[model samples]
Target chain A: MSNLLTYISVNDGKIKRSSLEVLSRCNEIAEKNGKTSSAIVISDDCSTIVENLKSYGPSVIYTIEDPIFKNHLNTPLLKALTLAMSEINPDVMAFASTEGSKDILGALAANRNAAALADVSEFDWTGDAVTAKRPVMASKIISSVETKGSPVILTVRSGSYDTVEKSGESKVQSIPFTFDKNELKLTLKEIISATGDKVDLSEAETVIAAGRGVKDEEGRKLIDELAAVLNAGIGASRALTESGDYDPSLQIGQTGKVVSPQLYIAVGISGAIQHVAGMANSKVIVAINKDPDAPIFEIADYGLVGDLYKILPPFIDELKKIKG
Target chain B: MKFYVCIKQVPDVNAPLQIKEGELIQDANRNILNAYDASAVEEALVLKEAHGGEIEVVLIGPDKASETIRKALAMGADSGSHILTEGSEEFDSFSYAKILAEFFKDKEYQYIFCGKQSQDTDSGLTGSMLAEFLDLPYATNAVGLQLEGENLIVKRQGDTGQEMIELPAPSLVTCSNDMNDPRIPSLKGIMQSKRKPVNTIAVSDLKNGLTNGSIKTSVVGYEEKPKREPGKKYEGEPDEIAKEVAQLLDSAENVI
Candidate 1:
């Protein structure tokens, strides 16, 4: 029996980086436990995805290519995954902490009467049980937890685990598509991107965040230009969103979405403590604020103390040249 | 129609965290209901206002959680059920869902609701897990919800965009922040909430006895994140700084 199993999620015919992270984490857990790791991908066509997944190094890769999965609804995918897991019966199962993944993982755990941890930022297998750590109280306190029972389910927080290179080959196994479609109680009518087909802030590699310093619509337009050049998701601090310059949906603070991207550039932001709590885990932080005493500079990898209006145009131009 | 909403009390996000004796201490300031749960309560109220229905808010927490439930009651929830428990720090999503399912299996409700996620654990697992435990279809991160005939249509925020999905009646949904503006309780509503029936159930009354050992998950303690040291700071011409920033992001960071 495989000791570790990871559910690899694919969107728009591509595997998300966070899914690979969960796979990498499973490999780590498997190695520590001296057992083999397995992976499962539910997609319409997983040939390319399975091929790409090899770099993460699982002992076996199982693909259930069913037309029913095209809808992106949870029940069909859950049924497929639950069935596969019932047969594999791995000691541990890991899922990426996305909306879809969380929905299915929770139910799957209940179905199997297994212990489940959600959005675990830190996890370790202690030979007898699995231990996990997650942030609580608005990321102020890190809560440590331990789980009991075989086949413990875990939802790994996105961007928390580092993705590593695979050391060996993995065997590909295509599982047969078998599910009663009539049992699906949910229907996916449509999926429309909110940002005009732009990447979501949580999944973006680069994020351009605005604060109160970007006072008006003109300033916001400049921020958008830079975001477009970088292909970055646009984020706003509570101050900007509250002032009606941006939507509350774009707010990033203690009360809003927490994002950990490869690069987070704070434009004209003072870096309130609440704002920093959300993106402090980012791999790199760049702060631009006229106020030299802005708290954002304290955690910034690169700090520029100057008027963002004068700085951003040149910054955008430089980025354009670099991209070209 | 009938609706069930899940509520949780969490530490105020605005309050400063204090570390005492190598352990995290709760802020003495007023504890507030989870923001998402407040949104969930508001969503349930909106539905109740449109269609004649009963709304009941459920919570599994310490005695103090009843205060959170009362807050929901003031917000127009008709009744409340508080499952009193101690040493619940280790109760994970699976165990928590099972308890709610056991409570709900006997009852017939048209819809179930919960916050997209709690600000405390931020796991966002309870609603979906409870639906699974109850053998019902569900959606998460829902910003918009409408009941059309026997089916429920919902708009959920996805990784890339918004998704429109329909689930059969007796389904579950989790409310995101922008679902609706939560209404402040009026003086009359607050007074009415005091008289609202808040049924309290002991943890042992549920299927699984409430204890850290009986639960599938257990907590150790909270640890603080390591502080980030200040990095390189540059102050000068925008053009020069921009060029240097681009070069460093490209060559050194490789994130450009």
Candidate 2:
């Protein structure tokens, strides 16, 4: 039986839930195939993350700790991943499709001379190759792709699977890694975080996305209040983000973050296909727009024809009442 | 500083698409420069405008893809390189990266830029793959770019925030379409693009050209995504519908 390795993505010392989701899927695949499921974490200190990963049930946890991994630098991270691939010689290496993982996925695949697949929604191991289904043409269609090689690299989109908790006596091994400063060809200046301490959009169960209808401070205040009431992450459409009303990081569309939260509330969004591609996978979609013929209504589970400014205040109050 | 932006011509995603016998068919005339690559070209032009330098765009496609190159040149790039390939070749990201590496092996440039991903495929692998093949420092999903004394400061959108990264010259970066609005070519600019220099080279002419064996991945087939049917529409008073839906979210949907 071959080995399946999941790269556990850690940001700010906290393990990403999406990584665990991938691990969960891998664990199932390993069990079905009678193979080994493993996980690798590359960060400054892996102890805490390792402890957290135990619940996800990877048989082997590989840790490569280095100070250089404190920030998302492609060079050192790629080296560490290549080293891990060589050390483990896994049949398939999977990753959660985060920005950090996306930064290094291709480089690592190239370095290892392995076949790579990005942003797959569904995947399974077939005899010697890995077959996956990924969204193409801006999520308008799904393409079934096959990667024929050993040590296939894959990055799975978030919310594709459910995270299952299966505690086991997992073995943790620390891989030896050291980086020379001269090899580091890039410098991380600083991170500009607009939504500080807010819930991560991709991970949150509920997301409140503002659009062009969220024009001014008053509309933004309503969105904030609604998000606060629901304890949801705040997102924005390209219109709002491009107009400087929201941070670019908050943009939800084909060009920005793809979110599949349990509940998504679109405020004033026209439901452009590009925008819909990012959140169509959301379990329950709620749209509030003035236009009755908006395309978003075609996909929204619950479409309310009204101005967001008027709808949000009462909606927030009702949610607060229910939450209390 | 000399900048090279890699572009691709992709079928317009907005255009109507049909799946016949598990193959996707699109209108041939609807092909356009990938939006993300257009942003890269725009960024290159902005950089060249600020700093005295030349911006050249490189594209790998069929002969007809030259129109995409002209589109970039109309956006203020100095020249173009059309790496011609047969329209029927089934090449994956690896093969593309290998061919681009060969083309740039002997070339000189301070920076190479590409779209974060193609609009049609959305693989998002070629830029970083090319970087690894050429052994260059690189970043992806850059929302903003700037030039320091000798380094390029890239503001990339990460999972949590916008990361400001600085890289030395001769690096590669994959740009996001969120950076800037690509300019619509003016009549005069389109006229000038006709006279601009574009060096076309066949894929077979590369030092070590691509072979079918180099492609490790292939699309087995295509299918329409499962459609999410619209549920219910409530057109009533704002407060009535808002409160009604909020209550339903708790009692009916159980999501609250």
Candidate 3:
């Protein structure tokens, strides 16, 4: 009964999609165990975020405002997180499987000696513990993890669940927290944030990436035009960037920027391992390559084989017509 | 300065893979150490050659993966350690990190290197996870690294280009192939590797919930891409290519 409370992070009452997914899954657990769920968002800038959190059907939303907790990541956030976890005393503490948030969660989970799952997409609450489906051994295999602990720490992947719908507001409360600053170990001086890029590939709705198959500067012109038409961001394979045909920011692959867009257009890229590592998470992958056997086709939802010399122009034309 | 290069063998990027009977199937192609990790090894060797000391390669995987170990040793690492495990394939990041964390609990190595991500999983989660587990500083995708007193003056490749970050000694770094061409195994080095140390470890030694339940995300299933019709090639006709391209772009692809 006391173990049903769940603490979640929210923004502007607008909870991050992954958080909603975690809450959605956690809600299922609460129902099964006859427990209650309460989510939390710690931020001083929380304007309408509390309203958004209310829509998700949390029994309570811990709204704590502090300049230190304003930023979503880094700054040894575990201090604030640990405080929230301890105060809420939830049966499970959850976070999104993200670079920054997960790092904080990792520390908290270790401190609490709770079972931690990385990048779990599915969840099930059996009698004793929870089971989740996670990619293991470098994404070559899928493994099932069974976790047991009062506060099971879970990090759900982004885009794993449907949008959080309004289940009506049950309760919302502003919880107070002032974590120690000296203990904050990881000091992120700067995020190396991207500016002047106009669009970020990771958050873009549409991405048009070029590969080595781009015949010449001609290919570049076509991609730019397509991006402009679709209002999509421009991305590139290492080959094009390595050849100095495009900016490194346009590069997508291993050691490159990871992107997950609604429409991912990979033009002239062979989809090497390094390149695939970046864009493999895209929802709809469309490949345009000259070689029919190019590896890009392996994960692509739609693949077009032919000389970029022949295919790209037609494809761009088709897109233009659709917009017109 | 003695260097430590952590190398991993992974499936070929272009290898065709499928899931059958709850297992993965892939083409039988010659396995190679990851390009990025290979670059790390090469960078280490250059350090070894420049400032003489042993460069040992460490591999933590199943026995079959020792081939990569031999390859790293052959490629120029002075010696190797293949911590062979019977069922390490089932190990999670925590499990894998625990093994390294427990094994190197007291061992001191000035520099530790790994690839940004393994080609097979491309998770790129381990080294950073290891750094967290070992309580060490970590820098990913370094283009170049130089030792400066008790710290490493390194230029790591970020999401964009090279970034300089200075971290104290005994830090973990993953090299991306942004700079320095990787080296192929030489005949002399390959021959000499036969006499180098290649130790193995039992999988059960570092046991403590080698199993993971950390929720991140999982691949629901393997999907095969559909076939496509090939497009025509453009010769030296720029005007004609542009016009035809423009028409096709307008009709099917949609850019200009």
The clash numbers for all candidates, in the given order, read: 0, 0, 47
Q: Write the per-residue lDDT of candidate 3 for residues B1-256, one digit (tens) a residue.
A: 5567878777785665676765567764556688778988988888777767778888787878888888888888887877777762456444566677676676778778877667665445566666667776667666677766656766654432344566666778777776578887889878887887888876566554344443323334443322334334433333354445445544565433
TM-score of each: 0.90, 0.98, 0.74
What lDDT does the true structure give each of the candidates? 0.82, 0.91, 0.64
RMSD (CA, Å), candidate 1 to true, equals: 3.2
Better of 1 and 2 by DockQ: 2
Instruction: Give interface RMSD (Å), model 2.
Output: 1.0
**DockQ top scorer:** 2
True contacts kept of each: 0.79, 0.88, 0.05
Instruction: For residues A218-307, write the lDDT of model 1, one tens digit per residue.
Output: 899999999999999999998776676875557786556678998999998898767887898999999999998888999999999898
DockQ comparisons of all candidates to the true complex = 0.62, 0.84, 0.16
Q: Chain B alone, TM-score of each model? A: 0.87, 0.97, 0.87
Computed on C-alpha atoms, the DockQ of candidate 1 is: 0.62
Error of 3 at A275 (Å): 4.5
Candidate 1: TM-score of chain A is: 0.85
lDDT for model 1, please.
0.82
Best by lDDT: 2
DockQ for candidate 2, please give it: 0.84
Docking class of 2: high
Candidate 1 backbone clash number: 0
The sequence of per-residue lDDT tens digits that candidate 2 reaches over residues B1-256 is: 8999999999999999999999999998999999999999999999888888999999999998999999999989999999999968768999899999999999999999999999888889999999999999998999999999879999999988889999898899999999999999999999999999999998887739465557889999999999998689999898999899999999999999
Off by over 4 Å in 2: B207-212
lDDT score for residue A89 of model 2: 93
